[model samples]
Target: MSKVEDAVAADAATLGAMQINAFDANQPEPLFVEPYAVTGWATFIQRAASSRSGPQARVGVIRDDSGNVIVQGSRHSLTCLLHIARDNDAAADLYGPWQESWGAPPPDMSKDRLDAFFGEMKAQHKAVMGNVPHICTFIFPKSRGGGGWLTAPMTDLEIIMTHSTARGRGYGMALLQWSNEMADGFGLPLYLDAGEDVVGLYTRVGYVRQPDELRTSKSLVPMVRAAVKV
Candidate 1:
């Protein structure tokens, strides 16, 4: 395998492990079926790597010299990100006080949702950075459809903290800084979605609330199921 291919595989493995670990650590009831998490991430990694637009999407991980994977983060395709945000607990936490939110947790291996999300993402792949692991968990950039604004564009950062132990370690800041530099390099306005608890953190980094655009939802079914599974 080429070096990049090897890297992608390693990253996929790391991310899969981290996702499972994070879920186990934080959820009162963990829902990952052992093989599913690993296999699922592997599938994502392979597909992304094989795609023509794959290289532009970055995947990163923190590892020891022994090459053991530690932390992993990803920037889902815009559509994937949208779906993720729709069902994301972390996003809900960030937006809870602002407005009521609702959605079901993503069903496992929902072929239709996955296919549609991925297909749309691939069609707009030029604007996407595939599941970036660590040091910019989830950042996305977009251009206005009609205006064709050239000099400046808009970008969004969506960071997810799956492990409590990973908090306060500066990893989050590192990721934010990396993302900001990337956006600044492209001369795009940086945007983000953060929970109320971490508002101060983002504020310190120069992010402001888009209060008018804020909306929230709660999924009692998913939440309860997650609790029971844990």
Candidate 2:
């Protein structure tokens, strides 16, 4: 089929599938996902903010009685990443400063040049429906790691976050419990990589660290929550 035909088919497939994956207290018009996979509720703030035009990933969210977003989480498919990857400026804005904060300098590449690079990769990496479950979560070696490589999870629980005002009210636990249930229903393990400071929180939620998992410069350690029979 032609590229336009392929895009139309893909979007149609995503629509029906999106309903089954909805994860939120109140849907976000289309769908709602919790903001981020937050641990250590004590450290409720994400120091760095990444700018992006919009997210192409699946998201879940929790809200207070007043209709405010209290918690959030998300999972990105390969197709989602491909779009963001094509939108290099958005990707850079979203992650560039986060990389810089880790003592790694930002790339010197021009915006056009960077887009061309990812455009090449987008052309090369064609994702089938089956690959959606295992999406890219973290890029190894980091931008500062001097290697530009991405590592995907078998099933990713990408980002979970809770607002400071909403912490200690059981929102974090609730969101995580929901995540567990969702994974169990899918019969796929939920995977994530965490930093040393917040590892305890995940451990409490049944995330077990693999011995082979190592921390990169960003200090991410791999952990997984096996699918449970619901």
What are the per-model numbers of colliding residue pairs?
17, 20
The most accurate candidate by TM-score is: 1
Across 104-199, the per-residue lDDT of candidate 1 in tens digits comes to 224553545434432332222212222321111222111111110011101323223223334344554444545445545544344333333454
Give one digit per residue, the lDDT tens place, for model 2 in 1-88: 0010111221323322322232222223312112211211111122212343431233334433443331233322211111122233
Per-residue lDDT for 223 in model 1? 6
Name model 1 segments beyond 4 Å from true: 1-7, 28-34, 43-56, 65-67, 71-164, 217-230
Off by over 4 Å in 2: 1-56, 70-154, 213-218
Per-residue error at 190 for model 1, in Å? 3.5
Please give the distance, in angstroms, between residue 126's alpha carbon in candidate 1 and its true position after superposition: 18
Predictions: Cα RMSD each: 15.0, 16.1
